[model samples]
Target: MTGNTLGLDKILNALFTPYKERVPDVNKITQAMVAKGLINDDSEILNDHIAFRTLGVPHLGIASFEKIFLHYGYKKKSSYVFDKKKLDAFWYEPPYSHYPRIFLSELRVSDLSKQAQNIISKYTSSIITDPVDAIDLNDYEKVGSFFYKPLWKLPSKEDYLLLLKESEYAAWVIYNRYYLNHYTISVHELPGQYSKLENFNTFLESIGITLNTSGGIVKTSKDGLLKQSSSVAKIIKAKFANDEEHMISGSYVEFAERLVLPEFKSIPKKKLTKEHRRDGFESANADKIFESTYLEQTTKNIN
Candidate 1:
């Protein structure tokens, strides 16, 4: 049968002719053109055949060319690696053979006291010792100390298509403000507090998100507010769990309406042990001296 008479040949010819016209140098396009008689003279064509040889097929119309042949009516089948086989290979591979791979980093505490050491030991069971070990302590600290449970294998092409759809849905919900806003508290040292807020506001502004201070309270701008609020809710829930007694009753919902800007500040509590109390006292004195010196410098600048 003529090459055009074959089903795969016909489909490929149709898919590739327009592509060839746009770019004649494309190997697939040139091959399809020669097969379809659009290109003249076999001698004029580059007869290298290396591309076809890599696929264990002899003819230019056979190796990378086979998919188009299959599209036609060539009733031949072979054991080509399919999506399922690739996914299976990924799961069975080393480092992933363990049901869930854990990422770990080195622990760095100036004084690894008994209490601190015990806490570190409990979580270090699943520590990843090799690839992550080379990273500096500061870089590791950014991710925080936590265990991550691998949920599933890396997504397949089909999985990614589904994820795209889900992402679209999520974007829609966020644009529409489908959920309620809740409080989010970020804890850091006192010196970095105001600067952090300013930086965060600048980020929001860059993204066309306005900061609303209506009702004398701070709130997120109208756009993308829902998604931002959901994130805040998660942070609030985590903080409330950490210190239940200190949380204000109905604070989350009220904060949403009042739109009060959240600030990071130190939470003081009585030390549980005498040693802890002494440590706190020493730290407080150092902070006091630092603040006084800072104030004196500021007053001089004003004068």
Candidate 2:
């Protein structure tokens, strides 16, 4: 491992800067936490992970995106497949615990209807080569800029809506294109009143934030060790290639609480660390969380 976090930190900061601007809920939740005294400021809020969405195609998806972090010393920890959602994802463990873990998901293009696959290929086929291979992963500046770079032309509103009918995720990546999907806050690491997801979710609702009510307001793991909730994706003004514009679903914020393992419950709070907590993710929990951007969840956020 390179053990070089200084450069990795810069690369991550590059990804976060634009995302914070794109998603207002980030500041809204952080400010709410401050108001509730759960956190003194953003600095105190431990980031559990950040997620990205991609197209599962030849030149892209996890295959290409994972290279950046893998070069930075992140280790692939687990694989999660959401068959119903037609998504495959893997979460990476950071070289240093202080850094947020990475969850990269890709839509299974071939599994989609022929019409949907055609729409996706129309854009991605032009790539001809893997774009990530063209960038110097060691250059934080180039890598940072690459996230916002346009790999394909903007989809027409008609094409976007068509993909929406098949895969809302496909519609999202068609336009959003590798924008940071969501960054999570480690709820268990907060003060007592907001430590548990149940309490923190209440606090978020109290502050006028809309929670994803897909599978109840809080989605818990079968083992009951991991619980999570997410705010509905921000509705952004999207100007499409069809010369039409409309407010569309964008990135959202996520909250995760990984509970202490049964064997580690005896450890003192001050001395206990992430090592003692329930680790990785739960597919059931993640499946519902992914709906944070779906039409059902986002409709409530509108108006």
Top-lDDT structure, candidate number: 2
How well is each residue in 1-303 modelled by candidate 2, as lDDT tens digits? 643677788888899999999899999899987887778989998999999999999889999999989989999989999999899999999888899999999999999999999999999999888899998787888988999999999999999999999999999999999999999999999977678899888888888899999999899999999999999997889999967997799999999999999999999888889899998999998899899999998999767
Worst 10 residues of 2 by lDDT: 1-10
Per-residue alpha-carbon lDDT of model 1 for 2-77, expressed as tens digits?
2233332233234334423332223432354355453453233321100010111122112222332222223332
How much does each candidate deviate from the true structure in C-alpha RMSD? Answer: 30.3, 1.1
**Model 1 Cα shift for residue 237 (angstroms):** 31
Candidate 1, lDDT over the whole model: 0.22
TM-score of each: 0.16, 0.98
- Pairs with steric clashes in candidate 2: none
Model 2 clash count equals 0
The TM-score of candidate 2 is 0.98
What number of backbone clashes does candidate 1 have, counting pairs of residues 3 or more apart or in separate chains? 4
Q: What TM-score, to 2 decimals, does candidate 1 have?
A: 0.16
Error of 2 at 170 (Å): 0.5
Model 2: how large is the Cα RMSD against the reference? 1.1
Number of backbone collisions per candidate: 4, 0
